[model samples]
Target: VAGDEDLPVNIDDLDADFDPKEYDRRMQQIFNDDYYQKGAEEDDVPEVSDEELQ
Candidate 1:
């Protein structure tokens, strides 16, 4: 299971003075990481044609 360490940031740490740019960068990084991981997993799955299903 994913843990807090896997998260980009702790929600409990955010305050009124938090920097938006930093937060955005962290979120983007997380998104990119997840996208890349998903793409990698997809590569392992074999592709099938419509004819194979018929």
Candidate 2:
């Protein structure tokens, strides 16, 4: 469960001169992934009517 390949990079290890555009792009990707995951989880649940519960 602890493979080196699966390890996340440390922020302190990043270059001091990292491009601001690259950081923005990476942040956008993370947000997109989170939004997609939430949508996918929501799709798995079934919606029931109030009448059905009665």
Best by lDDT: 1
Flag regions of model 1 displaced more than 4 Å.
1-5, 12-18, 33-35, 38-45
lDDT of 2 by residue, 1-54 (tens): 124343334564275567788778765764566556766886896889999999
Computed on alpha carbons, the lDDT of every model, listed in order, comes to 0.67, 0.61
Clashes of 1: 0
The regions of model 2 sitting more than 4 angstroms off are 1-19, 33-35, 42-44
TM value for model 1? 0.36
lDDT of 2 at 12: 44
The collision pairs in model 1 are: none
Tens-digit per-residue lDDT, 13-43, candidate 1: 4654678887787668766867678668858
Instruction: Estimate the lDDT of model 2.
Output: 0.61
Query: Which clashing pairs does model 2 show?
Result: none
